[model samples]
Target: MIQHIRISRQLIFVNKILFVFSLFGLIGAPHTHNIRAKRYFFPLFIAIDGSFTEVKVNEWKGAASNNRNQEEDGSAFIVEILKNLGADLVDSVEYGDDELTQILLSEIKDVWRRIVNNPKSLVNSGETPESLGIYMAKILFIAKDRHCESPDETFINGKCFPISTRERSEHCPENMGLYDDEKNEGFCECLELTKEKAKSELRPIYSNETGVCYRQNTQGPCENGEWFVLKNTYPRCEPVPDGCPTDGRHVFWNPDNSTAKQCWEIWTRGPCDKGQLLHLEQDSTEEPQVYCSYRLAESFFTYSALSFPPCPPGTLSNYVGQCIGCSRGCYGAFIG
Candidate 1:
């Protein structure tokens, strides 16, 4: 009978421990859900008092307040938040109070979407919703405290600028001037003397490594059998490919045609006028023909060999010489 009583006490103690664990689980579950719900409804919980309040999923009333003063104050607060997030809503004056509130809400929703999509950005799991909103605002908008990974890069105007750490005098070699804008931005560029020389004679490509401008198609610093060529605006010594002219006139074969076995002069006006380069034309029926065409800016140098004209204002040229129309509802000029 005594052993039976002891067993009953032991059972009661085990039951009590189980009940305590169940109670703790019930308390912890709500807290976990509350944190998740706050993140999930971050856009809806944007309060005017700079505090985050729990918002029900079904309780999103449209921004339609009877009090004009209260609505304007709320709109102003939202505008301030957006401006702090790097949003330049310069045309806000064009929108009415109701329209502007809707736009601001849309912008807030966009920010919330970004935060929700980026899981790795949630560094602090225990951060309050208000603090998280502020943290995410900095991340999505201004990025003022963003860390630059590159050793040669510096943060400027909420963006990364590839500025050198060398002295101003040593930034560029002789004959190259440092083009510094009113801002603290600068880059090594060829001076007027160098530019005139390049235009009169063969164009010289600037070398970032040696800080010297070397004439194209020449053995400036290259080893024997290799010539200095501008490979995508970068000065590099590359061997002359087979079947290409060794006289430094022809650099690459026509990218449009592999079977044509024809090579073209890249920068220099070979078999063309001073302002033109030799261009290739290949139609489905007609035989391949070559003609003199005006050279475009360095940005279009890769497309120099093609015979197609530049795309129209609202279109862009693809690699295969086809003009693709811009997507519907797109604004601004689309240039190559």
Candidate 2:
């Protein structure tokens, strides 16, 4: 009887060990998800000031589309490195089915106004809707912050520093490095505007005033509702990078960062959009310039892929073009 009891005890011990080891193998093993999502949102500034004045995009806003299909842009050569980074989680592999890039229309509208009145003010490398709004708040910070009695100089990064003539160097054009620095990630210093500080206007009423339109018909864009306004800042527009295609036959993709090239095609049926505005030439020597809207954010985007470029912190794993961000509410929650 004692011997039988000993055998039973040994069996229980072995079984418990085996069960725990199995749990580790199953729970700790890497899981893979195939995702579909968008990576970019086109900023469209609409004047809520109430007037017959329709925000017109003189460049490609209302232009006819023979080449650029608004909805058909599911796959092209365009890509997003950050969206591709979502799959790099511990014990996880993200597939095209697991890839996604999303933006909230509400959030997009909330910050869209900032770029409207200040054409030069744009969402550069990492500007999201919330980030832009946060920056805007700083601009209007004094109006809200009773303790603070001045207009603050906010950096593209959201750092707020005192506004001073000597501090003029703090402006990005004066210091281009600050534009790309992660450390400058907040509003700049403040300036003592008067008790009645005016917010940036919605749209410049006159050409001589301070407003310009913002247009984007290029590679890597997926969302629309492009906006415009009268900007007060000098140079009043984001300078298109010289590398921007002045000439080429390039494809685009979906905003979701979907990379299925088969989904994109060059239609010979009619005229394309970009060419109509940029006055593109098709001479073999003149290289065809094309701004692809959607494609794999990464060259090897999920065709036996490993990981995506990192999404901003607090993003969700969802459909292509579908994601959640902490700053922009990528998954849709305002943490602060």
Candidate 3:
């Protein structure tokens, strides 16, 4: 009986030790790369207002009949990862499987041609063509963040600042209001004026005031409105879509930024209820310019007037773009 009891105790002790070792083995083992076997693309953009927008791109593996469901699922998985990485809004842009194969191949051939012609472009020392290809493949799989001459402090390590604070920069443009919160305290944002203020204080009229329309009780977008008065401080209208002959593009001073930056005239698509206006091209060399270049609070966006519903504090938008109460709770809330 004593021997049996001792045997049972020894077995129990051994089992405990085995269990601990197994647990450690599982924890310290290298993670399998099943999901990573597929290629993917992710582009993260930081808006001037300090909002983080991530574009989750689907994988393109040079197979014509690639799976749509797989692409979508991978994109969704990436968006979830981005949200966990402090993304404010996540959107997906997908292409058909193998859709970009031709384009990429053409670009690669072009690069190769350039290298063959100018051998100096391909450093002969320590860098082989295969090594260059590897680096290029890495770029396609995981792109590096784009650098700017001046980056806002709110952006760090491909994520927006987590903390929220209220501080204003003395450098805000004239007539533009300054708003700052903890997460974006380091960004510079001009205040949006209310319609009432636009009408009363900074009364604006079209460049051709011959028949300028006016509404006594009309309001300007204090926040979340589509149209913003070009110049907030000294409100005045310059000949735009209707006023200009639409023959040629011209440059004018923007009213929002107190700085001296000349804004160029841009044409808009027929999305305008009126009609699409034409403009003279300044340079065909620059990327094909389009109309409706309205100034955004940030220099990053030009003439985007889309608006979504403003959700209350402590809530976030659902996958369907509807505002819902946050499950994890909101740390701070402000209109961007």
RMSD each, Å: 19.8, 27.0, 23.1
Model 1: clashing residue pairs? none
Winning candidate number (lDDT)? 1
Off by over 4 Å in 1: 1-81, 84-216, 229-269, 272-276, 279-292, 295-336
Runs with alpha carbons beyond 4 Å of true place in candidate 2 = 1-147, 152-270, 273-275, 278-325, 328-336
Give the alpha-carbon lDDT of every model.
Answer: 0.38, 0.23, 0.27
Error of 2 at 23 (Å): 66
> Alpha-carbon error at 83 in model 1, in Å?
1.0
Best by the TM-score measure: 1
lDDT over C-alpha atoms for residue 246 of model 1: 47
lDDT (10s digit) by residue, model 1, range 1-336 = 865554343333322222222222321347775474345334533422332222411122112122223323432322223233333222222222333334443444444443333433333334433455454434322222223433234345565555431223355564343432212234444332222122223343445456565555666568887777654424578886665654534445443453444556644576456787665432211222345566543222122322333332223344323333333221221011
Cα lDDT tens digits, model 3, 86-128, are 1111100022214233323333333333333333444323444
Q: Which stretches of candidate 3 lie over 4 Å from their true place?
A: 1-66, 71-145, 148-168, 174-189, 193-234, 237-336
Question: Whose TM-score is higher: candidate 1's or candidate 3's?
Answer: 1
Q: How accurate is candidate 3 locally (lDDT)?
A: 0.27
Residue 157's C-alpha lDDT in candidate 3?
44
List, residue by residue over 189-263, the lDDT tens digit for candidate 2: 111111111111011111112111111122211123212211232212232233333111212223243543221
